[model samples]
Target: MAADIRQLLLAAFEVEHHEHIAAIRGALGSATPDWNDVFRRAHSLKGAARAVDLPAVEAVAHRLETLFERVRNGASALDRDGANAVHLALDRIESYVAGLKDGAGPDMPGDALAALGRYLGLHGLAPEASAPPAASRAPVAAPVAAAPAPKAPPEPAESGAAILRVPGEAVEALARASHDLASTLAAQAPAAEGLARLARLARDLRAGAEVLAAGAETERPELRAFAARLGSFAREAAELSRRQGAATSAIEAAAVRVHAGAERLALVPAETVLGPLARSIRETAREQGREVDLDLQGLDLPVERGTLQALKDPLLHALRNALSHGWQQPELRRAAGKPEALGLGLEVAVRGSRLQVTVSDDGPGPDLTRIEAAARARGLLAPEGPADSETLLRLVFEPGFSTAEAVDTLSGRGYGLSVAADAARQLLGSVRLEPREPAGTALVFSLPLSAARRSLLLVEAGGRTYALPGGVVERLLRLERAGLPLAMGRTILRHGAGDAATSHPVTDLAEILGPVSAAPDPGNPGGAPPDPGILTAVLLRAGGGRLALAVDRLHDVRSLLVLPAPSFGSDPGLVAGTAVLPGDVPVLVLDPEGLAARAAVTSAVVSAGTMAQAPRSTTASRATARATILVVDDSITTRTLEKGILEAAGYRVVVCVDGQDALDRLRAEIEPVDLVLADVEMPRLDGFGLLKALRADGRFARLPTILMTSRGDAEDVARGLDLGADAYLTKQKFDQRQLLDTIGQLL
Candidate 1:
């Protein structure tokens, strides 16, 4: 009896083990796996194995737990070999548990233990070479197969989106709720129609009374008064009927929105759809004897599942292209002063309701000269015509365009980027490649956002109502024309008195949105005339400046879903996208960035006359064309502070995590940097070593280098100077002005 009970417990653990293993495998496939969850799964499996008195399973589970714990603590990483070993262990445990039904089945193999041992050895955390001896013997029982997978919802064709499965019911509740709401709204139509009938009846009664009053030849005051009262009752009843109809229409619109919201609720996060892609590509890289660390960002943003599914293939192609065309040999990477492993990144972000996805890598950026030659050879570019960067870059998307000397596994067919471009077009989006900062190439995709909620300030511009992002609005004000005085043919709103007060130029909404023929105007045709005395203006925070935008009327702020811009008309820069209001009304959502840019342009125009007052000379123009500075520091705070100061002082700045990164940037000539500001102590390479290398090289022998550190010792300062640093600055006695002056002198 005890033996039978033990067998039943073991069988129960088998099901639980399968589930935990599956979940862990899924997590490992993601670009950004939740290590905590992975650890928990492994830990639970170990406990389950121990409860069933399976020593071999328990031993292996404990090792997995150890391995996962190390990963969660960031003490070690799971490379290709480590991942393989984990799978091997899981497989061994599964087979061992499956055979437990047959008494005295077979000896458990030691291969899983040995494999895990080897993997953990890489990080100096190797476990025992063998599992517990008792698990070598398998108990006898009936054959037990794994449970069947539950039915899931419709999923992407690629395995990436199916990393996590959801029960069918997980999707039905919201749809059912939306359907119920729509049904409820439909019931209100009868009441609205009844109200309409009542209004019509009242109107007929009033007409009959009016006819009676007119037919009365004698001067009868009572009859006329009765007719007037009937007319008043008809008007009030009609108003009530109109309001009821509007209310019904509003309810119907709400139903539409409820349905849309429910559908959007089923939208899957980009991470879920793109998660398994990392492991798939990583395995491919391993097969090619190359390695990459892919970082995915903004993948948590939820979007329509179909949209995410559509992106999977193009994004995969882009990543494969990065690996193929941008492959740098280990020796070449070391020579270029970079890490042997490539750092790849895929970032998805929203730009004014437009989905922007980028795939980038830290490798040699595009060789423009080679690209131009390739284009010319392919006859895509005229031999005698100028080959500018833009024109040359565009050729990469050509169907048969390729810069490779020979076809290889990585890139030679030239259809990869072309495929991405075609996919973007099919989705009403666009794709482009640009050289990334500090080296490498980026393929950027700009597509339509299926649905996103945003807080919007709806205002009427040129007779049409549009939405402005509420975050960018400073304040909405109503002022008399006397408050806004004209200055050089421009209206200005001044705040405060004297020097403390600042003035901002004002522009009409009609001017920003162009012509709207429907605008009601007395002074001008096809235009809106500004109010003669009173003005409704929105004080907006725009592009490092302020702009008071004048409008005819201001509407309430609302949170609504923003869709991609409509394709029917020419899309203006100011129109970010569109949002649906009640009654199926579409309102244009304006881009804040575009509004700010326009405000800046208006300000420049308003200040055009002042240009002569302070004339710009050649020297001033040179000064404004900021000199580039490279700041190297391990502390992010220090790097950010220095960058901000330099930028504010009219100098362009680039930052690196440490001395080695700065050296790589310099060696690659990512940018023509005029000065190097480095910390004395940093990981990978210290300030002294960097200065020594720079002095040894003839190219950077006279490069202006500064050593800034908290080490204020005289010996440290002397040592930095001796190593060819132009200046040594101590953080203990730092002064911003003095630092700037020193850099100016060095330059």
Candidate 2:
């Protein structure tokens, strides 16, 4: 009976989880919520808890429901007290659910039970009301508040969005199971069967990731990629098992690592708390005569457990402080050479391995005079000591310290800065205060890429095989392990096979996947750490660009359909699909074209201003003397816009309809084209195939070419550049100036 009850309780948790999310959404609807909607949700939660025999959960929910019922019927109005009651009840329910998971047997705290009883008394409901009769409510879908509210209402479930929010507790449990699987797999010896099993698990894990991102926007490409990854990994695992021996160990390891990453990718939206935070901030700010403009960047950011929870209060408090104290009166601000209405800006960006959040305001910054006086009075500084701006600013974070003349009713309690500091520290993050370039101050908080796997090779580093597409690979080469040259700025390995000699770059092992173990063989000699010359290099086409990735082993190449990468911005990772090789181990197919586009956006060696900038030398004057460089992009607007830039800078620019037409023009043209600027991600014959076709033919092999597209990553760029591409550029990072500069350099 006890076991049955526990199982039922878990089921109830899954049911009520939807209600918790719905209740919050109902309260904060775009329009002032009709009180009945709020009451109905709370009432439903109470009845569900009661049916599950979780009396504590039922009792608290019951009291809160009645409290809202009173407000709905005009017996009591929505007030701060009512809101607090609701907040406490919700917090308690969450805590109880967490406890149940921790073996606390669905028990609620005594103080919380007492508090709920008090709340019921305030609502005039009998404390002993015999546990309100069970009320059945069909599962209310998890609220999709991120979607735009309709004018009236859409026909049921017709909302275009597809993501559904699952309870966090359930997700955490799944995550734990995934971790256990990883540990179990890691403990086994590296074998074909083991690698194959691990690869199938990776596919399943990717399916779980899709469920995680489910009910989010259907337009999110990553979700679809996740679904595709699962199928690919499953197939790949089967293939890995078919192969035998130690030579296949790396492939097996790669599959396992990829599955591990897919599990982490099953992350929920961390900014879920922001919806509540915004409401609280709005209400609190109204009490103080301040008008705040709230701006949030990266709302789609996915975060794991601790990092998401840790950010809740600190970010909220910082915004509240900005509203209550940071801004001056509109007229005063206008007179003092600032905008009348102050702006509160919150920006979140992922820079490499860090999540950077900057919150800033344009207000009287610290009132330097007051800070100096406070420092003097507190003996924090010598009477005539060196109290610089930075030194004085440091005092704000001190406990029980503030520059405000007197404690304010809303703020100036001196705990805001300390609270913010503590919250950042708890997340393995840091916070800083520095004056924005000109006026006011900016609070920048940095959080690490908590879910990112740490390793040298992204492919093999995590002991997993990522799928690489057939179309992306130009050729695979085995290098001599010894006597590699470090000239030409890249790791170049030289080898002699009969009369033929080959030289290759020793790229960062981590850049390709991670640090890889040596491929055992006597035919290859050994070199330095980065210059493990005997490694296999796969030249790939990413985002219609090029890259040459060095891998420790070369497994069989098979087709794995496209999967979306776990993306932060426009730049996805080096993956496109997941395929099973001969061993049934899953290998993530790298999209060299997509990767190249991303790399083109991020490559520091290529200037952002230069990649998209127009060329200065024109072919009109030297039409007979020089070869024309054609720029082919899909958008007529982009083509027209680019033509103007190229024309202005004196280049003979021929605008082609698409890659296919460009190829046709190249083949049948009378004049020799000096270079080609083509978009990679276009319909028909993409830039990658065009490059390959051109390289395969003798006519265009030596023709300088620059591939332009939106997809960019180091591997993609390397693949393109390695395949004889003169330049690889992404439209996202390269402006007209950058494009022109790249063209000039290539020319």
Candidate 3:
């Protein structure tokens, strides 16, 4: 039943979008204008907008609808100016409707919308005798010209009814099924083996709702809206399934309730987003002195209105970046062995409670030398030296930093990337850049989603109620509180000082909650009256890590629906997972490894049982010994990963943060290095220019150099490797093993 409703809603968006397109085209047609189609399309769009309670969209569509009504009734005929005005008005209406369909409609500025309406009124002919379509073939070529048609006051039954009707049962049934499936998966041989099955079922169920909401050709708008709610539920269900653990029961339960709430919110089809972006790319490329073909896959997928709305700016920025920085001229593309016309592709897929969106382009990749020069000139790099490509690439994300030689209004102010990143993060999403294989660049985004709660377990922490997975709990223990000893600082311990057995970490449940826990440990006793202390330590394992967390107390676990994480605030010890409990409280599930790591960092070094024999530490004694490779990058994660891979491959790895550091280390070394594996976009000195500088000096002229940066443009490669570089590899396209393999081959 719910599935039926969802189909109706999905259909409504499709039909509405189609009608808007038709109306815009019909108004722009170069014949005796078909006022009937325009009126019908506008009327349908207005109704659909109102059905979704998109008042902003409804207003624009309503005005357009009214304009067509006068024409249809033979009350007026549009003249040349009126035709232009009508076309412009239709364009605005189409954008507005499309925005609503895509979920980004609410934020459209009132002033802009009103200005379009005013333009229509000023340019339109009053009660004309002969109406004519303008000479322009496309809606974008003309201005808005039409008088404002007044709207009748909305009736409650029609306007308010669309806002009502929530699905309670479907949410409840699916949420329960999700909880049971979660438990079954945990108890089975492999925890993750059956998760995908659950996701598919949930998707199907949600899709059913969409079909219901959208399929009925004559269904009321409110019915279509009811289906939108189901889609939101389906989205949440998929998310919860991804992070299923013992602690998720209550979260699933709470999700049922949240689903009810989410259903009331507006929804949009995924196509709404894909269409405008594709169209804009086609239009923008012509102006940017390039040709681009936009390819969007999975347009039939539905996204929550909120998610779609939040996605607009980021998507737009990414498109602009692709065109401005990624695409090249037809000749250039052909020279690079790519299609003459550059191609930009957008792909969206769901992974657990996360949505993955990718935007990739086939064009000239970034130019590291230019980036290096720009960084040096901007003084972003220290005077000590320029940085490598890796460091320089990172600077592009910094606010107010632009690597472009000339600032264009379209880009290079250095704000878009950061802003887009910020938007995605707000949705508990992250974005990463990968150099396109062979050529160009690709940007990937991941977003968290709300899910249904199946089970819930609560833990007390820092004087408040915290949550954990019931599946994660091995067992709960009770011990007598009096048996524990105290250190000089009054810190409780299992035993006295100097005794390894005596100094067990002691935690009170009360201490965790900032309250006095009177519950005594059942084990320890005999000293005296029990002090006001209680402790509960939860043992958990997650993400290949394990640890015990001290909480105030254990609370009852129950099922509930959960919401998606808002884009900010790291919940302490909380893995990137959430659960729902009663009252729709989102319980952040703890990551045992992440929590234990924090504790491990604070504790004195736990001894590694034994150390592998180290090669004798030598000073700079062998000045011209066997070759050395210098690896430089600011990201410790990247550095570590690279170092491990290099060491495993039997190469001496010297890691540095920037070019200056590399040079310093080299000068200090007893042996002249054999090779340099440097990134071009570093903070100190970049790769291309760094090699040029090193070659300028007499000492390092013959250095076998390989530039490893994220810049993969043909020109960048040709300029660097052609000059002196033995090899060049974009970081995004090169895995550590692959990089090591390349280095081995290069040397």
Which residues of candidate 3, in runs, are more than 4 Å off? Answer: 1-269, 272-275, 298-304, 384-386, 450-574, 578-747
lDDT of each: 0.70, 0.56, 0.54
TM-score of 1: 0.46
Cα-lDDT of candidate 1: 0.70
In candidate 1, what are the lDDT values of residues 238-315, reduced to their tens digit? 999988877766765565566565555566678657754554566567558786766778877776676677788888
Off by over 4 Å in 1: 1-62, 68-115, 121-263, 450-462, 465-573, 577-747
Top candidate, metric TM-score: 1
For model 2 the local lDDT of residue 649 reads 73
Candidates in order, TM-scores: namely: 0.46, 0.42, 0.36
Candidate 2's residue-wise lDDT over 1-747, tens digit each?
Answer: 787666656555644644563555447332477778777877777777765656666666766676667778888665544444455456446545544542344334444445445656666765555233444532221211222211211111101221244565554455444434433333343343456658768877877877767767656677778778777877777666655434334544454455454444454454444434544554455446455545556655665545656777787777767766677887888887775657677776765445687778877665677878877887888888677888877777766667766777667787887888887766656787777656677888876544222111123322334444332344444444432333223544333332243333345434544332212222222422333435556555444334556655443332232223334322234443333334444444444544554434434344322222223465433442244778888889878988788777777778887888888989997567877888887788788888878887788877777887776654565455555565666777657766665566556
Question: Can you write out model 3's per-residue Cα lDDT over 1-747, one digit (the tens) per residue?
Answer: 765564456446645555575446545554666778778887787677655555555555656665667668876665544444444444444455444433434243343244445544554633221112222321221123323331211111112134344454654455344434433322331233356456677678777777776777786787666667666766776676666633343543454344333332323356555546655554455446565556666655655545766777788788888777875666777777876667788887765336788888887776777777766767888766757766866666666666665788568788878877787767766787667678888888887543334344555544344445443443343333443322211222222112122122333333332332222322222323322443444444433433444554455555544445434564433344666544544556544444544444433222111011122223322332234667877678878877777666666778889878887777777565767878788786777677777777678767767777666553464456434565566665565644544444444
RMSD of each: 22.0, 19.4, 27.0
**Model 2: CA > 4 A from native:** 1-266, 336-340, 450-506, 509-533, 536-747
Give the count of colliding residue pairs in each prediction: 7, 92, 110
Higher lDDT: candidate 1 or 3? 1
Candidates by lDDT, descending order: 1, 2, 3
**What is the Cα-based lDDT of residue 529 in candidate 3?**
36
